[model samples]
Target: MSEAKSPQSTVDVNTMTAIGAPRYGDGSVLRTEVVVRPNPRPDEILVRVRAASVCQGDAHLLTGMPYLLRLGFGLRRPKDPIIGHDLAGEVVAVGCEVTGFRPGDAVFGSVNSGAFAEYACVSAQRLAIAPTGLPLEEAAALPDSGMTALQGLRDVGQLTAGQSVLVNGASGGVGTAAIQLAKALGAEVTAVCSTRHIETMRSLGADHVIDYTTDDFTASDRRYDVLLDLIGNRSLRHCRRVLAPKGSFVSSAGAPGGDWAGPIVWMGKIVLANLFVGQQIGILLMRPRRTDLEFLAGLTAAGKLRPLIEKRYPLAQAGAAVQHVLDGHAQGKTLLVV
Candidate 1:
């Protein structure tokens, strides 16, 4: 793993510029320049990033999917020029009044800006300690995907012991975490992934693995109390066919399109239909927070939860890593070594 560079004597941290639109896939998005933003604000902690993960979500952000987001981000550019979401690093500087951290403490968190650089600033509330035995690359994969998985299963889906939960994108980042967390929560888990990934999900404790290429899961005779569609492919009408009575649906698969509209537009139908139907269609944004992160970290430390990192790329090769995620065959979380 690469260590983060210290702030230079002159105050410039070598940073990459997110100035260009990705013409096509990840290959077109290049990090070839350095930008030095003024040091972080008072409420922020500047971190020397040790490692970070390349998520599919980051790919969508780069591609400017969800057309609505561009208006706020930039008509043709990203508002946060340098983009990345999950980060794990040592604190290099802390603002006044910041507690629970010091300059050298190893920490992991999510932030709103520029995670792809050598140094990133994060809010104190979004970060938590990296477990002593955990690798920086592993812990870096936790915040966004991990929090989404845990929050989706418990808070959003209301998953319970003996309850059956089906995760559609069961081999991706959030899907991998959700499978383990659902099993840890005592739910009967079913995973939907490619045929090549069936055994992988089984190793993670999925009770059943349905290969989408071979057969359709929603077309199956079985029913689930919670249908978690991380891929966001199903329309409300199609999804309703598979839900059990009073079941809920939560979608994490973001769309690639005009502005920044989410799959919730389709989910909105699930909501309206629910008023007259028996099922309780559900959807909400996943917030990355310390309380939920600590729980995930504890699970990782104790062996109940683990990241299924399909691959790792160095900082220079980070664009390739993003491309891999954009290609959409990566089995789980993809990480970027500093």
Candidate 2:
């Protein structure tokens, strides 16, 4: 860890291109514009973003779906219009208080927001060295989805080696990571996806692949110790049928429910259902940590985990990228090559 300071980097460039939404609506609201590049605070680092990924959360911010998000995000419009969070980039400068990194380090991490630009200021605590063997584009795909999978399975779900774990909606960003992480945790992994993604799930080390297009996984007699639900398409009773008596059900995402509350309503339903059920049902709100980022990096370096990238877009096409994710049929992560 080096504590070195570079010159005030923001002096050279005042503006940079970014994808921003002036007001909330849909991906159509995202516009590529020349915005002021941010300066790193004393505890932050200025990164020249190489790649950033589109997440479902970005869609929520764009559309203001599940209206509850508007509470922290703005009552009428987003407080911060620039979108995106996960990124992999080169450290261009570091604030005086950021001791662990310096200029030119290859880093990957999550930020509060504003990663849809070529340059982003991120807290020192949120980033880690990019894995040596992976490309920056792939590393950019790791933070949010990877961390969500890890916390949902190992932390909230309390999954352990030899336990039977099933990942529903196993072909999207978080779903792909969940399948691999469950295997890395030594659980017997079953992945549920549409017919097209069945082979992809199997290649990711799933012990079984259920085609949701052809059969209802919940209708089967098989039981699992943990059910990681990335899609909330199934009812509580339907999902419960697949879980063991003492199993855990962890949800990281679900359908937007309606125009106002979105997944918050689904999360509330899950919480209320837990009180009377034998299985532990909970929703995963991922808290990103430097150590967890390092852990995922180690897994990637060791070939125990690999981020699956489904598509790439340029900064100009951010709207399409976001729309692709919101459509919810992507096979894996989607990246914006900044």
| Clashing residue pairs found in predicted model 2 | 66-260, 66-261, 66-262, 67-260
Best by TM-score: 2
The runs of at least 3 residues in candidate 2 whose Cα sits more than 4 Å from the true structure, single-residue gaps closed, are: 1-12
Task: Report the C-alpha displacement of residue 77, candidate 2, in angstroms.
Answer: 2.0
How many angstroms is residue 314 displaced in model 2 relative to the true structure, after the best TM-score fit?
Answer: 1.2
For each predicted model, how many residue pairs clash, with residues at least 3 apart or on different chains?
A: 10, 4
Question: Model 2 has how many clashing residue pairs?
Answer: 4
Candidate 1 stretches greater than 4 Å from native:
1-26, 254-264
Q: Write the per-residue lDDT of candidate 2 for residues 1-338, one digit (tens) a residue.
A: 11112112234377888877788886777777777889999999999999999887887678876677888998898888888999999999999998988799999999999999889999988999999899987899999999999999999999999999999989998999999899999999999999899899999999999998889999999999999998888888899998999999988876557877677778788889988988899889998889999999999999999999989987778888888888779889999998
Residue-wise lDDT of candidate 1 within 159-265, one digit each (tens)? 99989999998999989999999999999999999989999999999999998999888788898999888877666677778888888777666333234466546
Summing lDDT over every window of 10 consecutive residues in candidate 2, give the lowest-scoring window. Answer: 1-10
